[model samples]
Target chain A: MSLDQQPIVSRNPSPAAPPAPGADAVLVARDLSVWYGSTQALRGVSIAIPRNRITALIGPSGCGKSTLLRCFNRMNDLIPGFRMEGQLGFDGDPVAGPEVDPVTLRRRVGMVFQKPNPFPKTVYHNVAWGARINGYTGDLDELVERSLRRAALWDEVKDKLNRSGLDLSGGQQQRLCIARTLAVEPEVILMDEPCSALDPISTARVEDLMEDLKAEYTIVIVTHNMQQARRVSDMTACLMLDEARGNGHRPGVLAEFSPTDVLFTTPKDPRTEAYITGRIG
Target chain B: MSRASDALYRPRRGLRRALGAGFAGLCLAATLSGVVVLVVLLGAVLVKALALPPNPPWFAVGEQLRELAAFLSRIASSTNSPNPELAGFKAGIIGSLWLLLLVALIAIPVGVGAGLYLEEYAPAGRLRRAIQTNIANLAGVPSIVYGILGLVVFSRAFGFQALALGKMLWAGALTLSLLVLPIVVIATQEALRAVPPSLRQAALALGATRWQVIRDHVLPSALPGILTGTILALSRAIGETAPLLMVGAANSILFPPSGPSDYYTALPVEIYNFATLPREEFRSVAAGGILILLGILLSMNAVAIFLRTPTGQRAASRAIAQLGRLGWSGRRAGRSRTGLASAVVVPGPGASGPDSEVAQPTDQGGAES
Candidate 1:
């Protein structure tokens, strides 16, 4: 309830630093704890996000994986009663400081929601709108085309750019959301369960798109599927709910942070192994 | 056959069917009861307003139509009089129209602005909650109470002669506006709330300012609903007599008020005066006034209903999008304006010119928007 009385999280026996110790970290969180009106959501979630790499956060439901993803863009600020303590740095700058506007931060770090939420407008407008609102002085048509192409949705939607974005299939709509985010030219793309609503084929397309995207932009994705974490992510962070307090303070804490292959093949913590092996959540 | 299957097949289908039919019949009766009463009231008003002679109209339908046309023309041109033959609601009609326009101008923006502020901008606090609760309570307060408030506040200006509006058209208009303000505010709030939070989040995530998110996404999406709700509130205000009476509207006027400060009379006030007369012929005149008032109210409701439909909502949203594009593109180069307009202006199917190259991709195996 009080800042000084915030719950301390149990850390891994091994060092909590990610496997990529020397890699250029774009986002770094240290001793970060979050609360929503006295109900703690995340506790001491410390991790360094390497630049231009696909980092996936995988955990069971209500484990604060989404909350952690949202914190990168300051999206949790939208929620009422949301409060946080400790340091969250983006490019060596304190993100929650007064000098940094959340609007500016969001422009640099874009997000795609769990459900595909396309604007109720034409496909062309949906992509061009972000650029237009950000006061893009270049050719809007070119930007829209390039963003759609990068999302791998240009060829399918080129003939019908004038159609409503809602007219697209669930998969295409998700891709359209991606293209919309891309048009803003964000350095980091945060995806919260992007493929959970899509079929296998659409999910495969998105995974491939993610693989293509990591060569340029840093991506932080939160997914429930461990296989998705294995298939696309270069690095993975596994989180588990800390219910041991037994006082209704169920906060999520990081269990392991390692390279994707290493984390999946030989998890350091027993909880991570339990989660991956489907023994317990 | 299995024993369970035999038992299921032999269950009491007759009793179940009878019970379902009985329940459905009860629901139908409940619905028709209200409809039947409304139909009877409308029939009575129609007969009296037409002044049809008993048992003589069935064979003379053409003659009756000609007389009806004459009656309508007479009412359209003439002013109220003591004699039923010369009586009409032309002054009332014109005055009510002016009052409606004034109320719309005064109430709509203020009410809707308050609603938007309360729903979107206002912080969650005790003051905001108190304001919200007061507005909700104001909507349920009696019309006559509003009338008394209007009498003291708008007409008399609390004994300040210099500030008094003096029972003028503006005073009555202001009174009606105050009376309907709560309705409009509540309706606007409901409309704003109906817009999905996801749309706002989508816009906000794009680094749009709060105002930009509301202007570009939320407002346009809520326009149809707001329009319908506002129009319905306006209709309710138009039929209100008690408030206008307290505000000192004239029961009889030779001509409609030509300016805001001039004396005015509304349809409901004139009808009430006519209906209270001892003469039998004046009742017919009152019925005619009633018919005219009903016609106005019905048309307003029809517009509201139209705006409520999917087709109407889509058309409204498209027009808003077009307006938005024009404003947004006007600031940019004029060359791109035409290109953007061409893309947005033309509907998807069977179009030529720049949009022709863009084929319609209709069969996407998705839900219809």
Candidate 2:
């Protein structure tokens, strides 16, 4: 039987080859596959995230967009039974290896979770904890203020910096989380549906903040909202479930990777077209 | 309406409502049964402690009140005597307090540390589950079982002279510590588990190491819950007599323990000794001793409840207020006859459950779609 005709053991080429080197790619994944125990979640997938640009990973639920984002910072290490195969890179350096310290890797590639997960601590402490623990020797007060300002949060929270972060509005708490990530001075920011918990106004504000932030930091966001992927991203990667195998298990595969405008406006893979046109996910 | 809609909204309405109300009534009755038993016991203890007249106290309320006050003062101040009028639990009280201090010093650090390791560091698998199950089962093992274990392992050191601790005060303290260690561990685990996983994830994603995550976010959030659980466990320890007996607590002693090595007798052990005596006088003295022990236990448990209160200001002031109320009401009106007993029994089961005190919103809006 042909390779494609095999039930579940067959391998296929990635939907797209990884972007060539010197595309100014800061984070790159090649033929990356992930498994949680016996079940595969991500199939062979390749993509490149350019430096100083917003790269959005968009797909339906169960498509491993968040899984890919977490792999960049190795946050997937926290999940028991999570296993990844294939190369993941940060700043052109290998990241998905045992020799690398995840704590250090996470410092350089910080993340914001799907929900607004502010510490139940003072606003200032929430922003400062990362820097303090990462041993930032600079003035913490100045760093906190600068980070909050960068996240468009300083003015709203300056008066109550000592108040519990949990007291803030959901949008404000998300911004505080962004501010916290920024405080660690990471070069790459991984966001897993960062604005999904916020209202439209907050979403628009966060979108603007992302537009503003890309000049200084590379960003990779996993969003279920196709409109959001179109609105804020420079490069977009679409992931989708591969064909269901004989046993009915389907794993996520990269469907398309290109400039956001082209991917959204023009034709590409039939699956991408179907997803963009709302016929399939 | 469609048949489906009718089934969803109205089918079995009468029976369901009746069952719900019946269940609620059953729970109320179940709860009240415990409180009623506790109240009756407290009432009996109060009558015995005051040695109240059977039927003539209606007109001599003032005289009876004075006598009650005098009895309380005498019990609080005097040492144990074979003479009923002079008998008191001064040595027992002092010794129990010493045992409490030592037990807290030993148990808190060890139990909390073990809990932290199990919850945070231990790999989740068969071994962790085995240890967890064993610790849980240990919490249910009887106090006398622990007393026997203490006698063999801590006091006698299994007949090894170099390790033998003998029947020293520290031995008893160690025994009680073992008796309550599982409680402390279970409570600490529950407290640590109460801290939301999101907090840990947030900290970890910020590049904080595991230790940093726990130290910076997890520990602080879990502290109040841990304190509440530990205090309740200690209260349980304070009222234990069987373990102390097994570990060789003195039935009678002249002076309170001066140090960990000194021979000691606890309030419960002393009360048991007096209660078993043939004289009616010793029984009343035992009753007073029971009152004193209950007061301490209830106050500790009250503090535990106050700590569970989410607001810090209310926690501090309410704990102080409750402690004061317990002392004053127990002394003056004997009002603890109902209120204190019920408070003591209800919170034991309630507070030991998951840290329900902090109501974290569970909905993860849009939840990673």
Candidate 3:
């Protein structure tokens, strides 16, 4: 039950990248590992996501960066038979325990997906769905307007709130999605490649939104873009997958995790160094 | 991203364009035939409707037209027919309205509820597949078959032995419910499927219970669709004489049906009775009755089509947007001028309840807004 005394994973690199001193612990994912049938996507990864800050999970394709973020509030529970060993805790409670209901936890941890999956509805209706589901019975006009405002998209989309979410350009739709999440008031926000579908300027807008939002919610982002990690993350966890001959398995691993400035400047691990230098992923 | 580069490996541009034109032409030709068929059928209905007449504009059923139009002037000016079958038509119109009410009440809830259960809760596997296939098969079954079943189960056993809502309106309502239940359920499921899973997830992420989310968000978005399907099905039920026959729909009911076992005869049954009469005068009466019947059928269909229209669906979404605004109570009370201004001032925390920690500041400067 004690997280600190749990067996140290031998394959894990040195503790040079442990949560920095004095940082607020929001989501403490300790000894987290995920398996989908015979294939293990994540192996014994531990990282501390700080409160009111962005912790970017950067990695190449097939790594379990996104998987770790899903564990924060057990979004993985939606996927059948997705088992995780070791305790990933929130505050001090188990993230995936029976006592931690997925519905309530999900409310505390909202997510914006890679593709902007807006409901096939008008912009006003799309923003309103979050509050309505929570049995909110108050002034709806104000709630809808406030959510759009927080996402910094109300001005652009305000006049056309009645228009379909689909009519907006791809960038606008993504911002709409962010507005929808803001409406929910999640304690933590998990973003899985939130800007991958956007152009560079759109990507910058989202990154700016991320910066603005982190003051109120813990943000954990999983992205393929390296420059994005340097730009937005306070802590960067670079993940990679290499052949594991001992088990004849090819599983994604966390190569190194360090503060964003340090990781991009001077990563301790060679694989981390190679990944940042664009030599090997 | 040059056009030439994008087209480099594609068939030579001119040839590709020619092939594209040919394909478009083929589709156009096929579509044209469909349009022609629709026009011809519509033309036939109008032409036949015009042939029956003794009044102004020959084909017009004066009093029936008054009822169809529901115009104050027409209702006052139109003369009533001395013909009894034509007289009984007033009763049929009333009956059809009552039937529409019954169908909507009994079928909509059952069908939509079943659909939500099947789509949102059921796992994708054998049992789900079987239920899906069963529903498909049920939808495909003829309305006449449901009529026969209604006669046996509703008229004989349940209505008689149980004495629950006897040969009354409920019996016909029951039969029609079974007849259209599959269609409503199927539409509801498709509507639910059409809603992005992200919406469901987003709601759950905001401390919403499953039922709450379903009642407020999912149901509102899906309402127009469910009603559209149920209305379409009810319109189908209105035209059904075969099923009502097995359940003992009377041929000469001078009065309108008030309840379950009143021997209800819908518009179709009324038309059928007139068409079978030996008198030549009765045939024109049937034609007039047919026009009335078409009017009722068309009205129900028009309502269904209206519900399915994009504008109608958006209208149904008003309740949901209202609920979303409720989650932010105070700032919305003050004007923000723009939807974006109001949204930014809306509180983020305590989204679960109203008056829960609104994030708004200074109620002052928004005055200009």
Candidate 4:
């Protein structure tokens, strides 16, 4: 039970390890580390997110899964005193570069937060706002309809398009958020525990929607639920807390990255095996 | 033994009830004391004003209203006169109304803008913190101090000497505006701060520029609160006398102010002049002026409360909703006109048809697993 008696497990893989040869990665993070003030959250974590697939980051609480997901779209930049070391690139261009405007970057890389956050506007406006701000001059009605249908929420909300987005049910609101993100036509969509706030039925619907959405846009999801990772993700990256390192509260680092089946059935790292088996988190 | 112990532990209900009743009585007395003083003061003023009666029913509400209307008309039409009975507040009313208009025109926009910048866009550092603290302190500063400041700044420093704006209506208006600006800014800032952070985050995440987010989301939600605060600030400015006095508001004028640069006297100033004179008739006139001032302030407050109500908000949203529908319909008509060209240009990316390509991978992944 003592702290020193715990095993010093090295979850970090060699830097020379290349991504799967034929995989088309839309995002490539190299030695990514994040710190909030002096407290580190992610430590040299690296992963190549494949295109047209759901890459789910699964781990326990305080495992930097959400932090790593936010790093893809640079959401962490919103936080004060947030420092990032290492490179995150989208389509071979550095995300944190001075030339890369976060506004434009975010447009191309949309995000869905953990909670369902819809602007206090109508459903139609919620979807249209993103496109409008991005200077989309096309038929907004058509676009909003298309996005809602793609999110599997068109039938429920088409009649009440003028109704406030906040008036919808929680599940509908989340789908509205998804539709809003889709309206902008982002190349990649990042979701941070998108279904954590929903009921089982809503979560299942979102999972089904995600499965359908993977063809045109890449998705990177952070989930605390192990079954969700197994059910929806094509590839699973398990991150774990490295308590023995740094000032007793060291940041989380990736323990295993493999196909979902491989990670579930035969994890390369013992820590990942322990986590997936529910022995220790 | 249990019963004995229970009796020992139980509270003295009678004594406790007595103490509660005593405290309640004290609070009731405290509230009534204020009401009592107000009623006594108003009664005395009314008795003095109505010293002479014309009919049998001297205190009828309708009769009093008629008399008040006649008295106000006399005051409105009469010019300044040496006779105490004929002296009126026509110049005061006009000056006050003009001052109110100018103060609102200048203060609301400036104060609200400062509030928005401070609350939304200002960098959270020492400079912003210092400015915030200074604004809060300024709101608490004495009105007379602001008067002196206005006298030096707007009246003397900036006012062209030949134009004589230093002792004009505009100068008094400027002083009152400055006196209330800090209050308006502080209230507006509080209102803006009450807006949910999630709304901002949602807008920003949708790729909105900061200004767009504020204009499109934040401002609409904070509108009611902002209006209420501005109204309250304006009301305070309307009733202010000390600042105007310091800025040299005239005690008497022959005619109403013709322009911003003309000499002016306000309701409070007129009342002060009349009340200070050694004449009973002038004191009654001053009481009448006080009644009118109270009516104006009360009406302004009522308007503020009404606007802050849910019904007012619903009306506003309804108007916005109508506009939205109009725009939507107009766009629909335009699309119909350009149907062929639009069809070719639309469906650029992430459209439903292209989704078929994305759907395949998900199907394959499910099959493979």
Candidate 5:
């Protein structure tokens, strides 16, 4: 079977390729299609996100990478007219099943958005808000401190925990958002262009934090910056809009998914190769 | 060539400058006309209040202050005098206070709840749009119309009389609350809408339930705007006589309202009654009542402004700090160094007071798109 045809074989590794040794699948998508009303944003995209590793979705604008990331946590459900049809499994459980509450799914799979969106609250409350609502009866102060420490923001914010979260610089605010997500103790963190709004220094800090974070939490990041994918991600999935489909409202499709080194060095699809080499986006 | 170019530009520039100045002068005159009319009317009212035909000495500033003190004492004593000159607005004040309390109790929760439902939970459809349009229309409906509705629904249909709530303070309050409900809801919806979608998304991504997000983040951020709206609505409610009249607020009442289900007359209604009398002495009484009404309205507005202004919050915190210092000094005189150390170590509720009150609104205001 060719690489393009293997996606149709459900519940099996691609016959044209095989899973890398010891890379466990934490999240697996099979022919996932998403639509916002009549507009199909993603079509028949399939990829498995490995546990304890970073998976980067790299694509040009209008490629539905962010939409796919949002689908993992059912964030897309918040948008009116958003519809999805496909198999999406997290740890072998159906994510879109009626029995699986989006709220509960979101608790297990936190997301960091493109822009830094800290609550108009104190730095302390920003981190503690998630835990408090989740009925965490433990020491919230300690949890806040630990989360901030994990996000590498403790030392800078320790003196002024009562200050508003928005008082922080854009970079610090993004880290504060990360701390907020981390405080929930999610198994997976889906970041949609987390570093897109940051300066290089802050981006480096976040990238480094992601590297440290991957030992415990599976991460899926959608990035426009290909160099970021190469530097931070363990595995990379390249998606592209299918221009021939849907009469100019074409849906995004997964073109390539491989280990970061393999995909960057030897991308099987010409589109992926073109995208990586700056020939086309 | 430069002189010729300068000559060409100068006349046009001068003309533009003159036009700007003329416009500015026109605006100034327009503003001053309102201010001048207000001042003249206020002066007339003051003169009438302080110097009625027979008893100019009684309404003298010093005598008026003494009378005010006596009136306050009379209110504290809960006595009702029938004499028009000495018939202090004790009953009206009490009745208005009762009405204010009831209106707040009824309007705020219902209005805010409606606002939340409309803004957050209501789907974008014809029903929601229709409801929004109706709310806007309701806000524009005259106060007297609300009173008529209140009379029909609350007094006649509900038979509040049969239920022992006849022509009472609560009935008037209900009417006034209904009159202002749309205004409050509209204001609250606008305030809630002003909250950034990003904040809501942030909370949701953290796995917060919708209510949890609203209560913890959105409400706190929107509170200043909501409060400003509520106070403005209440101020309008306080001055409304036509609605209260329809709802059966007594033109004249002998006794102060002791409870919700008692015969009542608000300050505006009392002022209106006093103003219409054939006697000039009654005019002084009416002027006095108007002054009192203006004072209440102005003070409510002042409170709203204080809450809305960032600098006002800083000033309030400074005052609080001064009070704290006074307490600290008193403690220092009574106790030793250990007490001071304990004071420094113990984080009071006030520690987070200023920022929580001040920061959210300022940040939200700045961040609002």
Candidate 6:
């Protein structure tokens, strides 16, 4: 199929808010909105996914947390009748347009979906895949070892590098997913509730892994787990629904965005407080 | 107790439930008729094969059986040498083997590759949808039509004269391969789909390219399943008759197809040829041939069943499950080359390092559609 790719070469190089830099702000989402046919899911959402830090988006069910996160990498484009209006840029390149290829965009902004999706391959092959595709030429074992180790899966999976990745435990599979993502060496990594499906032990382990991951690459995660948000993320964006059903049909909107500590301890919106305090979903 | 069991325990107060159970039992009994017929046929054939003749000769019922036994006896008992000869079934056996090889060569790769492309790489759109529907339709197209296509295309158009140099053999192989292509594609696609999409995403996320992820993870994981399905398809191709007729299979050929250009007689074709005969003895030979065909099919299936190569993940899962609650040291102790069996969930690495980890799949690499 013909994939659309157009370079927005002449984009205004200025941002509305400058994220204090340590690592570059690799991906910037400006007023992104999404629709599934006539049904709107996200409405006028803006967020800066900074590099080398884990930014967790937390909200209740039907709050458009996952939808806004998907916009950053344009994975929303995959679903038929799934449309988005607004701009998402990767490293100053516009990603939220038909002209921008999702495949190419995904290569740079690697993603780990909610489920641990280890390919039906050997553990070694799974980690080595991204490097191979991008024309990597070096010691493969070293690369595999490095990625797996980073994912905390290398020590466990080293012996059976030739074995299929599916044979791993749930936690291991999620880590394998993480390792697989690392293989591509994407600047921005999107984890869409990576630990939501795992057991408590696995969730804790994945949280630990996320903490380690933020030291290297920018991470954006969408989760319903408030505890996980507090544990793994440096910055947190809380989303909530407005009483729009009474006014007219409208999608969920972001209630507040701030540093993780500040947002959890003292949220700007009463809706955010209501959610964190278990008063309202 | 299970909710279903509890529901059943709840007294059936209505006639409708009783009627429903009766209908279910009726459906099952009806289905068993087909199953019983198959079992009975199998039992009859096996019994006939095992029951040796009680007469003095005590020979098999195949056409060349009595004569070959005589010839062997003469050579052994009389100390007289005999010219090296092959029984009729020998030619049939060789023809069948070569045809299977050719079909496997042609049908499997194209079918599985197409399956992979359709399931993995293809975008959901009009063209891909059309191709998928076309493949489904092709699977349902009459086998006789494939035979006709083979005849017109290979024999008539390409001028394939015989099976000696492998002409009829190639034609028949191509026709049979076409007949089974849709099956393989469908089987492979299903097998691939059964595999979790996370595996693909995991590989892709790991800095693996799309091809790399598919090659390293997706293809290998789906290998055993795809192979099993393809072998099933091969069995279907082996027994085909109408397609052979289309591709110029010999009526009563005495010799095996020596090359790609020779006239060949396959098992079904040989059986078909014998069954159409005027003599009662020839019909027995055909029945004997039917036994032989069953034997071949069973053995092939058995071999396929026996030759299951476990995927890395399967082995790992098994090993890991066995080592339940084991720590790193215990995991290490149980681990061999079998797989990396552990429950550790590590964070992924930053993008940097050598890219050589992704190796290409060995067997199906260039062997293509």
Best by lDDT: 1
- Rank order (by TM-score, best first): 1, 2, 4, 5, 3, 6
Question: TM-scores across all candidates?
Answer: 0.91, 0.86, 0.76, 0.86, 0.84, 0.74
lDDT of 1 by residue, B1-369 (tens): 477668657568899999999999999999999999989998897677677343346468887667656776677578988788898888888899989999999999989998999999999999999999999999999888888998899889999999899879998999889888998898888999999988988888889989889998999999999999999999999999998998989989998889888999998998999999998877877887887889899999998999999988987887776676545444553333323334544454474333221222111111122
**Tens-digit per-residue lDDT, A125-162, candidate 3:** 67876766665666556788888888889889765665
| TM-score, structure 2 vs. true | 0.86
Error of 3 at B218 (Å): 2.2
Q: 2 or 3: which has the higher DockQ?
A: 2
Regarding lDDT, does 2 or 5 come out ahead?
2
Measured with C-alpha atoms, the lDDT of residue A135 in candidate 6 is 65
* Off by more than 4 A, model 6: A1-24, A97-107, A119-126, A138-169, A199-202, A242-250, B1-32, B43-87, B158-167, B303-369
**Residue-level lDDT tens digits of model 6 in B1-369:** 467667656565787788999999999999999999989996664443333333333444574456434433332222101111222354566678889999999988899989989998898899999999999999899999998787777667656554222346777888888899999999999889877765655544444456655655566667667877888888888888888876777776665667765668688877777667675445445555677787778877865564355443354433442242133223223222121212112223432122212222211122221
lDDT per residue (tens digit) for residues B190-262 in model 4: 8888888878777777777888788778887787788888999999998999999988889788889988888
DockQ of 2: 0.34
Fnat per candidate, as a fraction, reads: 0.48, 0.54, 0.43, 0.43, 0.54, 0.36
Residue runs of model 2 more than 4 Å from their true location after superposition = A1-23, B1-23, B52-63, B312-369
lDDT of 2 at A159: 56
Among residues 3 or more apart in sequence or in different chains, the pairs in candidate 1 whose N, CA or C atoms overlap within 3 Å are none
Report chain B TM per candidate: 0.87, 0.79, 0.70, 0.82, 0.78, 0.69
Total backbone collisions, model 2: 0
User: Pairs clashing in candidate 4?
Assistant: A215-B358
| Global lDDT of model 1 | 0.84
State the displacement of the C-alpha of residue A116, model 1, in Å, after optimal TM-score superposition: 0.9
**Which docking band does candidate 5 fall into?**
acceptable
Winner on TM-score between 3 and 5 is 5
Per-residue lDDT over A78-168 for candidate 6, one digit per residue giving the tens place of the 0 to 100 score:
5678988877777777876657766777778888889877665457766765776676665445667778888887778665565567778
lDDT of model number 2: 0.81
Candidate 2 lDDT, A1-281, residue by residue in tens: 21122211113223474442244667777789999887789998877677898988988789899899999889889889999998777765678776788989999998999999998666766887798788776656677788999999988976566557888999999999999999999999999999989999999999999999988999999998999999999889998899997778789999998888989998488888899899986
